[model samples]
Target: MDRGAWLFWVLIASLCGASAFFAAGAEGQRRDVRAASVTLESGAVVSLAEVVDGDTLLVATEAGEKVPVRLLGVKAFDTKLEKDVTKTYGQAAVDKLRVELEGKPIRVLLHSTPKDKHGRTIATLFVEEHDVGLDLVKSGLALVYTVYPFPTMQIYLTAQELARADRRGLWSNPAAVLRADALSAEWRRQAP
Candidate 1:
């Protein structure tokens, strides 16, 4: 082949390769954009199939997938395992959650890490257009657990502090001493 012809073919091949690369990159970006949109705008609405505890529940999606959902930024009274031995003000916290969300459809927004170590979906829950995490903090059922940046982290934290000062829910109970111990026990019980 002539030198000029060989060079022209090489240029064409390079252009084709570049086009393919960009097309693939664009496709990947499209998928990412879609996923982000879903996570941010459209939360999965599911039925509360099982209650893991006062602050967590197992939700059954419309697609028949059962996912364990941990209420973001809140820890309520422990009520799943033992009925007789209850934490101070624990039953009140559980009662509040039950009144707000039991048997209702809940919206679940995903975080960067979808699941925790126990395979539960770590997400911010919502009911009736209200963020469940924020509600828990406002009601003093849970604390603001900020592991990563979220849209309403600051607001939730502030609300939780106010609730703590007001001594709401478990905060009011003198028996509920030692935040670290309570948290550690909760984690240990939940851990697989």
Candidate 2:
């Protein structure tokens, strides 16, 4: 090809490349939700690195940025934290969540602010169509975090009540039940 023709093609290609780069960067910054395109209604799919407990986890974006995510509207037994009540079933809770989510791609549904008090991403996580918080409560490994404005609060409340009534999981253990009662009361007092 002639020099002019070759130069013209190069300039067009450079412009195209610049535009594509800028467009990609704009897309990344526009969401401002959680990382990895996690929208409120749809959510982004991410891989679970580990189940921190029934209510918390470590997840990763496709680019491998590890994010701490706390399950919205869930309160599992104490893991390695200072608690007013004893941790009667922490391992059981962890095991359940781990089996369901660890190393698996799960969808994180945004609910409230992107982060919690501890800076963990607060979202409703799902495996396929099953909500992790709802499943844990239904299995009696967790309780509904009763703070208002939580999505699916009523469903969690009813499910937790049924679990308690049926004496399932931690509810079946008297010590755990007692501890949970104290914890609930304490949370109520501390809640805004």
Candidate 3:
């Protein structure tokens, strides 16, 4: 091929490469923007729409959508238990969380893998910079769930130990504790 023909082909290749590079960058920017809008980053204030259970809540997004958020690193007793003792403990935990969340905007810290298999956002919530999950564990309203890894796992476990020792909330009754522990084990077995 002649020098002019070779030079023309090289120019065309260079333009195509530049176009692909810019296109990729633009796509990356768009993803970043979309993530910023949907993801509840640290310190992102969210209104509590409903407390579904002790460990789950519905939060209202800026787009007027209600999203279910499951508290990361903690598990509360199942509120649907047939046993009166277990049911009472579950209801107490729900009431505690509900009182805490009612009429307040809390800050959400989302995990990298934010959504669970159930499509609930796995997050840690804070109110006035206090870790809500840790508080719940400390109060014995919830147990430390170690099935899924989280940064504050050790702290939550320690808090759970203290709550159990102190006989606080659900830990106060041996029957309730036994039922809750059995339920927790069943949940772990079912975890994917």
Candidate 4:
């Protein structure tokens, strides 16, 4: 179950048959917990373990909990697919991300809409303020995900352009194998 759903049920169970005054107190506790989370997120450093893809990772927080954080601003190729080319690029992306992110101390910056539908945090990861998503786009390992708004959209878009111009990583594939025009059209379709 998602954390929110679990928490909701927990609150309901606690508040059941309680007085209105007790319910108000429970509400205050929830707010206090939220405030604590904000404080924890601002400067919390996490130890990385697994790189799920170019744009997601599994991190071990100080509380000994594993959190799946989806890196904001970029979407990477999925290695799980059957296509050879997609798997090739996906593996490269995962390898690069694992090398750079795994076993490292990194900070997570939660964006305005922090969590996705599945409860994974939507956050920007930093290694000394350098965004991991931007780095991947710069290396052509990921594409800018503009299906929604993000603070660093332009920065990611510029990196993708530079990578394309230099024919780096994913852009290194021949036009016969990877069609730029088709990709561009597809990306446009994803834009809001």
Q: Candidate 3, residues 92-131: lDDT per residue as tens digits? A: 8788888887778788998777877766789999877888
lDDT of each: 0.67, 0.78, 0.81, 0.76
Worst 10 residues of 3 by lDDT: 31-40
Clashes of 2: 0
Ranking by TM-score: 3, 4, 2, 1
The 10-residue segment with the lowest total lDDT in model 2: 31-40
Mark the regions of model 4 whose C-alpha exceeds 4 Å error after superposition. 1-40, 175-184
Candidate 4, position 113, lDDT: 82
TM-score of each: 0.62, 0.72, 0.72, 0.72
Candidate 3 similarity to native, TM-score: 0.72
Q: Which candidate do you rate higher for lDDT, 3 or 4?
A: 3
Q: Quantify how close model 1 is to the true structure by its C-alpha RMSD in Å.
A: 15.0
Note the residue pairs that clash in candidate 3.
Answer: none
Better by lDDT, candidate 4 or 1 = 4
- Tens digits of per-residue lDDT for model 2, 1-192: 999999999999999999999999888565333443432233788888767676888787777766778888888877776653336466678888888886677987986477776667888888978998898888788877776457588888899999999998888988788877887787777768
Q: Against the true structure, what is every candidate's RMSD?
A: 15.0, 12.5, 13.9, 11.1
Candidate 2 local accuracy as lDDT? Answer: 0.78
Sort by lDDT, best first: what order? 3, 2, 4, 1
